[model samples]
Structures are given as structure tokens and as C-alpha cells.
Target: MSDGARVIVGVSGSLHSLTALHRAAEEARARQAVLVPVLAWTPVGGERNYRARPCPPLLRAWQELAEGRLEQALGQAFGGLPIGLPSQPMVLRGEAAAVLTGLADRPDDLLVVSSGEQGGLRTGLRRALRRSVARQCLKRARCGVLVVPPSTLHEDLRALHRGIDLRELAAA
Candidate 1:
């Protein structure tokens, strides 16, 4: 919200999301910017269709669950850091791709997300039918976008935990 640049990373309780969080934090550190870890969710179709406003209690419960998950993700991703960085955890109520893509409005802001490499055939098929977050951001984002692909044999999770050039990761 301030004039300072922001490194916005979309996150979930997945290996790919954790990788994105770590990379996003590194970019924020390099740029001396703020890091924002965001988790977005929408109610299941049944809940959305059954109620006019949806149950207030249920919505609150969902928020609490999402917040807990985000907290866990941040801890897991940056637990071993030598120093703290300016970071904010956000739980947004909406679709993940839309919310993340919307955050790329500022010129200096950078957005980070992961390709669903861990996702198997079903997920791939769904993404093929409906664009994944990375694809949507590439098409719609206004600022820089870094999409960390599903790490392969050469560039795996352990390697990611150590460190990888954000630019190089983006380029891959």
C-alpha cells in the first residue's frame, strides 16, 4: 500500500508454493522491498449456491483455517533465515489467480507464483481447460512476474532451499 515496492507471492500448503515463497522473499531482500504472502480461497460451490450470504460463522471458520495455513507456510519457508524481512501474511477471499494478478498494478511491484508441477494429470487437465495462475499472470500482470516451475532432477527442492537466482528461475 505504501510507495515502496512489494514482492507479492501467492502461497498454499504445497511444495511449489513454498518454493515460490522462498524465492519471493529473496527477491524482496535483493530489492530492499516488502514481502507479502497471500493465500486466497473461495467457498465450495455447494456453499455458495445454498445460501444467500453464506453462513457468517462458516465464512469466519474458513478465514481462520486459511490464516493458519498461511502462517504455517511462512514459518516453513523462512524458518531458518538469519534475519527477518518486512513481510505480511494475507488471507484473501477470492480466486487465487485473480487476486494475485490484481496486485501487480504498481510499476515496481513484483509478483511470484509457482507452476503446478506437483499436480498430476487431473490438475494438468483442469489447468489446460482453465488457465493456471502462472499463465493468467503472464497474460494479465502489469509488473514483473516470476513463475518458479516445478523443480526437476537438476533443480530440486533441496537446491531451491539453498538458493537459486530468481532471474534464472524465472527465465527457466
Candidate 2:
């Protein structure tokens, strides 16, 4: 841990998350804080299901996969961890919002997360159906919460994925 300040960012390897990660890196650099990028995961099934099955090998494999994802997300965001910036990457097993809020339990820490509101109706519906991580962090974080909105590129990518014509959106 850094002596003075810490910037905690939730990372899930999504484009929105990567945008938040980049913003968090910028915040860390400006504040001279340690950057803590966290990727949270759960078992294939819910915790109840996992408890019933209790397969150690599968649990280990899932943890390894989460580790890989954290590395990959960092690489994709900065080609690797940002040079000249102090970073501690973590792969924890829990719900994303809970793990992030739990780690950001400091007065001076800053919690960064995506708004998770990009894409079309399906995306909106999906987020509405669940408790959004960003919303949860905003509500529960002990530290300052920075909710990064989805970048234009992320929205464009989502539109492209849905086969929507960009020009039509532009004209509208």
C-alpha cells in the first residue's frame, strides 16, 4: 500500500471498465496515489450452488482465470501496467460491487467505476434487472466514488455490434 493515498478501480475487462481503468490511472498519476485495479469473480453458479458442489479444483481454475483477465485488462488498457505508476492488481472472489466497495474502505481512497449504461435497450434492461456496480459503489463506498461514463467509442462499438447505421444515429 502507498503511504498517503490510493485510487481503487473496478475492472471487468469490458470496454466501459477499460475506460474507467484509464480514467483511474489518470487520477492515480495526478494524485501520486497507488493504483489498485480489482477484478472480482464468482463461481460458475451462485455461491449456494458452489457450496453444494464444493469442487476445489474448479474453484482454483476459476480463480486462475480471473487472474488472467485482470492481467489482460491491464495490458489492453495500457499495453501493460502504466509505466512510472505504482499499481497493485487484485483478483478476488465475490460480487463485483461488494469486493470493490470493501477494498475502498478508506477516507482518502477514490473508487472508480463505470456507469454501465452504454448500448441499446437490451443493455439498459440488463442493468436495470440487476443492481449496477456503479450505483452500488456510489451508494456504499466509504471513499470518493468516480463514476466514469461510457466513452463514445464504446457506444459506437455497441451500435456497430447491433448493426445500427452510424450515419442514421448521427442524423438523428
Candidate 3:
């Protein structure tokens, strides 16, 4: 917690991401900043229709569905979190790392994301993209970036989890 105005947490539908979200929430509360949990929706490659366009209504409905699921996930993860913070989840249409890096461009914003948990099967492109995006964010973010790994954030969070006044935490 510092004199930050906002903290953006990248929340993928993974256990590690939720852990990161919880930590970000606590940091936001302590810093007197609003929490914006972002769930990115990037469409993987599909067969291109050479002579057709999808309906706008259909796309809107799909967006709505994704938002609804995000809401449900938030409720399930943070319902009893005991986190007293002003926070909301936003579902955006874009690649995950890029979206997060873009948001980190704000002057008083901090980027909090989980790392080292995407070890299932990283395609060559996926690996390259992730590394590129992460490096860019580290270099460009105006405020500090918190890269929380699944195994480390738990203890780090315990140190930062004082649900007290933000001003006090920042001043200290």
C-alpha cells in the first residue's frame, strides 16, 4: 500500500489468479485505492468466414454471458474474503497481458498479476507473447508492478493484509 489511486488485478479463471486478486484487493484497501479486477477475453483462432459477418446481437449476447460468468466467479471467490474494499470486476475483450499492460500506463495505477502458473502447455507464440508483454509492462508502468506467484503471495499477503485505514498504511 502506497499513495496509489488504483490497482488493477488480472484475474484469469485459475486458482493462482484468484490468489493474486485477493492480494490485490487487500493492497487496494490498504492504499485507499479502488480495485479493478480485469478478466480478459481473447478469442483464439477460428476458421475465418470468407463471405459472412457475425450478428452484432450475437456478439453482444456473448459478451453478456462472459460478464455474467465473471460476476459469478467473483462472488464465489470473494464472498467471504473479509476484504473491505471498493472493488469491481471488468470483463474486457482483448489479449490478457496486453490489456493489463495497457491499463498499467496510467500514472497512479499499479499492476498486480499472477505469474509462473501458466505451465500447462505454452505454445511457442503464447510463450513469446507473454514474455514480451510482461517485459513491456515492467518497463512502462508508471507505478509499481506486483507480480505474484502462486507459491509466494500467500505469505507476502499476510504481511500486507491489515484491514485498516489506507492513509495510515501509506504514511507508514
Candidate 4:
């Protein structure tokens, strides 16, 4: 496939990322473009205070794991080989947001990613920090950016619980 005629989706083996991949694939098919699934990974201990950087072996291991996870996510998204549009898996070694943003700069390429983590305390903290990957892409992307949010059922459930609590508080 041509370099610019591609729909790139960032995957992390999570349900949200897989959903983004599925959406990206559909977009690619609609646009008559190729689908490129990218997973960015970095070693946990890299640039630690005690050590300047992680060893090569550790980096290699992490890269291998990321590649495996990307493969699994691809399988989950397309149920094995994708039909119609050409699909490629890319394992990048760097921060997810930066890597995705860099790819988004490519001309005529569409970058897709999950908007944010599903509801959780950790995710809430990340959102509070304004550190979401999708937010970064939205800010910096030169190409088309699609931030695929989680299903609305999760939001509906949250609203339902909040409404019940609000009613109880009002009664008090």
C-alpha cells in the first residue's frame, strides 16, 4: 500500500484499543486505504535513577512482548487475516502518544486511537492530569485524527448510579 493511503490505529491489547482498531479498519475499507495497526512499547525500568538505561536484552524482551500483544490484538479485531483492505502490524519502541502523533504527521494518513481508559480510579487520575494519549494526538496531529471513545453503555451506567445518589442526597 502507499505510504499516505493508510489508516493507522494504535493498539495496546485492551478492549478499547481493539475497538479503535475495528473502527479504523472500517474507515480504511470505506476510504479504500490500507490498515496499519501500531503498538508502542517501552521497557519499565528504562531511564531509572539507579541506571541510565535498561539493558539491550530487556529492551528486546519488551519489544517481543509488544509484538506478541499486537498480533493478539490484530487477531481479536479482525478474527485473523483482515479481508478486503491490506492490514499491517507495527510494533514501535517509544511512548504511545508520541509514536502515534509522529505517525499522524504523515500526509493523507488517518490516525485512530482510543479516547481514554474505561472508568477507573487510575484512569480518572490520568484524565485529571490531562495525560491521555488521544488528547495529545488531538492537539498535535497534522493528519486526520479519530478518537474512539468507549461504548455509551458504560456512560449510561455511570449516569444511572449518579442519578440515584443525587436523588438520595436531595431527600436528605
Candidate 5:
């Protein structure tokens, strides 16, 4: 895709999600597009009865701290770059895939998501949900869907790029 396109990435509190966010930002820079870091959180199975919905002092303080951290991280990631595309963080309230599909209204936009956790009894459940969401997102998104496997992109799990000169590329 061309530079200046919109690339929206989904991130949670997990390290995997953060890795994906970093990769998404890098990809957006390479493509000369704007990076939209979407931090999506769901409030435990959507089971809120809306009892008053008043902000407790502690909760408000915690939320304020969280927002500050997010803004700081966004600034560090996007602002530190010398001459790259713009990146902004957006907080979304919903399932990651559903929100991505819903937000992707233009063909120029690209959605990047982590494949998800692997290996364990609960692995099956995670894979199932990921597959379902991936299918829906790939079909629903107007643009492209980058379903990144955890092993392929994350630092703890990165494969060496074949025939690539990192020093030359960096200088370029």
C-alpha cells in the first residue's frame, strides 16, 4: 500500500499486543501512513448492570494514571522519530477484531492484529476465538488484514530476514 494511508493496530495490556503495536507503527512509517494505535479493553464479559456508574475516587485515580501512561508511550513511540509518519493512540471499548472491522471503513486502511497465545489447555479456546475473529475481520474490513503470528514478529520470537543488510538499510 502507499504511504499516507491509515493503519489501525489493536493493542491490549499484553506484551504480545505491544509488540504488534510496535510493528504496526514501523510498518506505517515504512508505508508513509498515519499510525492509529487502538488500545481496546473489554470490561469482563460485558456484565455491567450500570449500578449508578459513578466514579469512585480510587477508580478515577487509576484511570487517570493509565491514560497518562498511554499518552507517554504514544509520544515516545511516535514523537521520537525524526522524519516519519504521524501516529496517534485511540482508546476503544470493545472486542479487538469486532472494533477493527467496524472502524475499517476505507480500503486504504490496514488492520494489524496479533495471532494470539499458543500452547496450553486454554490454547484451543484462544485459537477458536482468534480464528472466528480473523475470519470476520478479513471479510469485513474494507482494506487488508494483517493477522500476525506471535512468533513471526515479537522480539522473543523473530526470524532472521534472508539476504537483508540491516546496516545499509538503516543508513538508507
Candidate 6:
């Protein structure tokens, strides 16, 4: 809302997240706001397991991996950081929803996330067991929330992976 507002987006290196990142960049450019792309990570065996036996070296390695992932996602999304748009990429230790909501606390800030819908029985089952980041952000974020759906290419790839022939579908 204000000229100094920020556009915060969650990036997890997934196709849907990349789509959201691009959309967030577009929004930031349009609104003349700073783009804050955040990547959240948890320990390999969850926080409780890590806390039970904390390994500082492993933790540092994981943190470096998270930073690399954020950089890779940004590179894949825009070849590099978007030109003419101020950007701040962050790697935090937490769940995606909590990290994103916490960063986008300002009322004028805009939070963007992916719909997180993938076409696979295993993925569907996994998602069913957990609330998606987008859903959580929609419920918890104080700022404006924008959920970007997966791109058409992503759906087509999923269909292909499921053995649906695109040529046959196009012919039909």
C-alpha cells in the first residue's frame, strides 16, 4: 500500500515456488517495492531430533545448503536477480509458512506463495497430512496474500509423468 512496502515470497526450489517467485518479482516491479525472497529449512530429522543431539558442523552445512538452494531458485527464476528491482534473499531455519508470515508482518507488505498442488498420489497423500504454506499464510499473514497457481507447463509435465500422452490429448 505504501511506497516503501515490500513483496515477500516463499521460494523452495519447486516449480510452483519458482512460478510464485516470478509473479512476486512482477508485483514488486509494478509496485516499486523491494522483493524479499525467503527460503526456510528445517534440520534433517526435524527440530526435536536435532535438539536432542545438536551437531554444530552439520547445522552449519545445512545452513549453507539452504543458502545455495535460495540462490539456485533465484537463478532459475530470473537467470539472476531481476534487474531494476531491489531484492533481498534470505535463508531461515523454520517452516515455510511461519517464516514467510513472520517476514511479511507489515500491513502494506505483500506475501506471495504457490498453490502447492501437485498431481501424484504420493504427493497428494503427503500434502493431505500437512497444511500447505499458502493455506497457512492466508490464515496467518497480516499483509496482503497472493497465491499463484502452478503454471500450465507444470501441469503438462505432471500429466506427462503420469503417462498421459500430450500428442494424443492434443489430437483428441
Q: Output the number of the TM-score-best candidate.
A: 6
- Across 1-172, the per-residue lDDT of candidate 4 in tens digits comes to 4555989899998878887888998999888888889999877844362167547787778789998999888788777758777977799977788898887677799999998567789789878966888888888888999999886554555657667554554477
58-160 per-residue lDDT for model 1 (tens digits): 8788889998888888778776331568887788888788888886688899999998665558777887777788888888899999998765642555457
Compute the lDDT of residue 24 as modeled in candidate 3: 87
Report the C-alpha displacement of residue 113, candidate 4, in angstroms. 0.9
Query: If the candidates were sorted by their TM-score against the true structure, best first, what order would they fall in?
Result: 6, 2, 4, 1, 3, 5
Candidate RMSDs in order = 7.2, 2.0, 10.6, 5.1, 7.9, 1.6
lDDT agreement of model 2 with the native:
0.92
Model 2 lDDT tens row, 24-139: 99999989999999999999987889999899999999999999999999999999988999999999999999999999998999999999766578887897788799988888
Give the CA lDDT, 0 to 100, for residue 131 in model 4. 81
lDDT winner between 4 and 5, please give it: 4
In candidate 5, stretches whose alpha carbon ends up further than 4 angstroms from where it belongs are: 1-4, 45-48, 51-83, 127-133, 152-172
TM-score, model 6 to reference: 0.94
lDDT of 3 at 66: 70
Candidate with the larger TM-score of 2 and 6:
6
Q: What would the TM-score be for candidate 1 when compared with the true structure?
A: 0.79
Candidate 2 colliding pairs, count = 0
Model 3 stretches with alpha carbons more than 4 Å out = 1-4, 44-52, 80-83, 118-136, 152-172
Q: What is the TM-score of each candidate against the true structure?
A: 0.79, 0.92, 0.67, 0.80, 0.65, 0.94
For residue 128, give model 5's deviation from the true position in Å: 5.2
Candidates 3 and 5, the one with greater TM-score = 3
Q: Write the per-residue lDDT of candidate 3 for residues 39-127, one digit (tens) a residue.
A: 87754342143115556676677678778766765776786323677775688877677778777677788799776444435535577
Model 6 CA deviation exceeding 4 Å by range: 1-3
Tell me the TM-score of model 2: 0.92
Clashes of each: 0, 0, 0, 0, 2, 0
